[model samples]
Target: MAAGDIIPVHLYLCPLTLPGLSSDQQGRLLDTLPLDEQQKVMRYRMASAREKGLLVRCYLRALLSKAHTQLNQSSLNQSPLNQSQLNADIDGAIGPSEWRFDYLDKGKPVLSKAFFARSQLVFNLSHSGDYMLLAIAKSPRLELGVDIERLRQNTNIHAILNHYFTRQEREAMLALPSTRQRERFFDLWALKESYIKAKGLGLALSLKSFYFELSETECQALSFKGLDARQARLEQAARLFLVKEDSQQTDLGNDPQQAQPAAGWQSKLWQLDDEYRFALSLSSTDPLDLRCEMVSAQALLSE
Candidate 1:
């Protein structure tokens, strides 16, 4: 990626196969939802969100069901409180983080607000085409955002960029060599969007305020708008990062400031399993020491 680029830090792929859950398995799961979550499900019952939410909840319950069996020969047909206690030791270690499902959480996740209503693990999730975009915080309790979109070859680049992007950004694309169509456009589009999501201020930031410049190895971001320039005071990205020979600027997730001009945000793009193109983003004061792991919903299931 060119400077001010949003590079993907890691990629995790899980199998789709899941063992069917029995009635006892399903019941044990819903019984763990907090009062508010239960009420929210009740309010949105029968909706797609409700269905997806329940599916994820059941996935968690299944994991716990297995765990319960291992810890003791306890049947999962117990009261909710008992199940919670029996699974306490496992929950403490595995916890909500293991489940990592945000298929129905609000905007960007706030640890406390989304998972269990007030925890602070800070992550965001979105899925497009056949992939999911997961933006996670390494630490420092920062706000994070990420997106993964498929390359629709026939997309009208001029139109979409004209509408969502500032004039200069569009010009950069037009001025590019005819050979750099799909890759360049997607890189710029992702960087612009990922930056907006990171700010958490939504569309309030204008595309013209910043520009992502492309270089041989990476992209760099520069702030044209005073608002974005001032954002540096908060250590937010006003530019992007491409890659280089040195490793001093490795983990942008924890130390985003390492990204400099002539190379925009530091992000990684990977072709995974021949099914999708993936980009993961992280913003931190320093490059994050991310412990990347690939786990299935089954791995997180309770005994």
Candidate 2:
């Protein structure tokens, strides 16, 4: 495949607290959203929950608008049409507030067909604790999902594993030392959620139908500071597997080789902070090049 055919995924992490927007700015930002989105934001019972919802939607619109502009500019450069026509096309481009959305039967939102034709962008949104994560890829062929979880000491890890996880997955976590079990639980949960979200099946797909085999791999040293620097120590490479009950030979620790890899899917896990675990899944057979950056509330809103 040519270089242009390969999909590139972009991750934007926005913290809800840093450089918080004022009341007036917040109202104006809310006003920019579509009616349904504004109502959705209002439905959040708690102030914090409402703020997170607002930021995620607004940032999504800003990013989509930017993507649309870049796509248009790229096409304009290649078109034989004169500058006058190009200028007219640029003026006709849709704004963030004007964008439309459609949702899958399972509640995963996607760009409406009208706007999708102009830019074949696919995106997924997730939030946990004080941060919201947005994953975007610019190809109709690509599907993307991202999830973040803040590690907490009060979670009932064993009960959850027993109910939702595959036998192999449960055994792997149980075998771990008690001190590490919580972290391991969140790791698996984030990965599984990302996979389901990527598939757009939500909880309609049984969690036991699939499992992930996570193993440590050496990652490249990060030259940049801040989040990337912390990621150097926390990121672990993982592979996805499907449960084949009839075969009955899948073992968590002893015989990983017997498991079947889930083809055309790729996932990565990262420790964004001391308290948060993040994972991303993409439907692509090609090598993945995922770029991540932390964007502040001010920066995202200003864009």
Overall lDDT per candidate, in order of appearance: 0.44, 0.77
TM-score of each: 0.52, 0.85
Candidate 2: which stretches are off by over 4 Å?
A: 1-5, 18-20, 71-93, 221-234, 245-259, 300-303
Off by over 4 Å in 1: 1-94, 97-107, 113-120, 176-179, 218-275, 280-285, 300-303
Q: After superposition, how far is residue 260 of candidate 1 from its true place, in Å?
A: 9.9
Per-model C-alpha RMSD = 14.1, 3.6
Cα lDDT for residue 137, model 2?
73
Residue 243 C-alpha lDDT in model 2? 65
What C-alpha lDDT, on a 0 to 100 scale, does residue 279 get in candidate 2?
85
